[model samples]
Target: MSVSQQVIKDKLQASIGDIYHIIITDTSNGCGQSFDVIVVSDTFEGKNKLQRCRLVNGALKEEVAQIHAFGCKCFTTAEWSKLVV
Candidate 1:
């Protein structure tokens, strides 16, 4: 079964607590095999890139198993704010 973008978004929101921004792109041409994502949340505040990815991966453990490719960029709220400005 292919996972929808919204389902992934909801999962992230539920697992990560409060999120400032989330961008998810279906890079597998709607087959749900690949996705590129950007997530901004305070949950990443003290974590390095690997740790942040682990959190996201842990949250989406089942989904990640099904997906062929998944790429994610995680940032703290403060880091995201600087990039957007």
Candidate 2:
């Protein structure tokens, strides 16, 4: 597609402040378009998965409109620590 991985990362960096690693993939480009964004920010604190997804959806409305889908996994720094999977 027209957007590059770094571009997506940058957009996310701007939109989702405090993100630790804004990993992006573009399946549309036959690479890894399906993003697995690991954001370690307080912004995601208290927000459930659905709410986090919605927040990401709203934040990336412009990019979302262009992409096929999003494989989002947002988490707070604390929540990320408790993950076993």
Candidate 3:
């Protein structure tokens, strides 16, 4: 019944749509209790950091309640492109 990284990634991709990139890491080192997620998508356009986090939190509400820790970094496609270039 524990939430896995793939589950989180799938849910996010489904909720947000058209993800440019996504990386979910199990920071708990195999415990499956904590995670770090980095997502880049156009769904974040015009949203600030807090707003973006809220959107992600809302999408993962149920899964987050089951996990001990969830860290998310969301970026718009433009923002992500800037970082990589």
Candidate that scores best on TM-score: 1
Q: Clashes in model 3: which pairs?
A: none
Model 1, backbone clash pairs (residues 3+ apart or across chains), number: 0
Q: RMSD, each candidate, Å?
A: 0.9, 2.8, 1.0
For each candidate, the alpha-carbon lDDT, in order, equals 0.91, 0.68, 0.90
- Sorted by lDDT (best first), the order is 1, 3, 2
In candidate 2, what are the lDDT values of residues 1-85, reduced to their tens digit?
A: 5545676677777877677545465656555445445556678888888988787777777766765666677878777767735
Which has the higher TM-score value, candidate number 2 or candidate number 3? 3
Q: Is candidate 1 or candidate 2 better by lDDT?
A: 1
Instruction: Give the per-residue lDDT digits (tens) of candidate 3, residues 1-85.
Output: 6799888988898898778999899999998999999999888898889999998898899999999999999998889989999
Off by over 4 Å in 1: none
Question: Residue pairs in steric clash, candidate 1?
Answer: none
Q: What's the C-alpha lDDT at position 71 in model 2?
A: 69
- Name the top lDDT candidate: 1
Q: What would the per-residue lDDT of candidate 1 be over residues 1-85, giving only the tens digit for each residue?
A: 5677998898999999879999999999998999988999998988999999999988888888999999999999899989999
Q: C-alpha displacement of 26 in model 3, angstroms? A: 0.5
Task: Using TM-score, rank the candidates from best to worst.
Answer: 1, 3, 2
